[model samples]
Target: MKVTAWNDGKKTYGIRVGIRNRDRFFNKSWRNIEVDIEGSIYQFKLTPGFWKHCPEFRDSVKPTIREWLEKYNLVGWPKRKPPRFELVQIDNNKFRLEKYKISL
Candidate 1:
């Protein structure tokens, strides 16, 4: 598993997670999970079709996602609501969700 921070211009923006090695459940290509962070909260969107392929998506990935968020100092920001997430999957035993706009 690999975690990468993405930036636009001078500010750190979001993260992309990539995983190699196909698990027993999924095979074909690598997998990626994306997270968009705004202030101290993050969000991931999931669709029904993705759930069909991997029912354990949230169970398998949420902890790692939290770890990555903390590692980047992107968690626990003062916000009106807590962070939100959705379940999704990719080819690798890994998964990635995507896209967010950040304020400087």
Candidate 2:
């Protein structure tokens, strides 16, 4: 997966994820959501008055690409892994990245 950031011209910024193979079976697209980036750590903030949902990222997000690495004990960014089946599940789940075999 890849993460990209775009500033909103003030101190605000939003993030749209490039999930390798996210079926999106349980979540919506990560568009228009504010995200904070600190090196390998990624954070998400929900605007006030908006209904919070998502069991994984309901209120806010403090996700790290490292966590995913820890979960799978893999090395390198989108590389060095023998294979990630979950990512495949995501590919089958989502239709955005039909060709997601790239190196960073």
User: Against the true structure, whose TM-score is highest?
Assistant: 1
Could you give candidate 1's per-residue lDDT for residues 1-83 as a string of tens digits? Answer: 33333332232233322233213334444243333333333333332433344222231334545565456565654443223
C-alpha lDDT score of every prediction, in listed order: 0.37, 0.30
Report each candidate's C-alpha RMSD, comma-separated, in the order given.
12.8, 11.6
The residue-by-residue lDDT of candidate 2 on 1-104, one tens digit each, is 43232223333323233332122332344442322322232334433322232222222343343344335443233423222221112232232211133223
**TM-score of each candidate structure, all chains considered together:** 0.26, 0.24
Off by over 4 Å in 2: 18-26, 29-43, 46-104
Per-residue lDDT of 19 in model 2 = 36
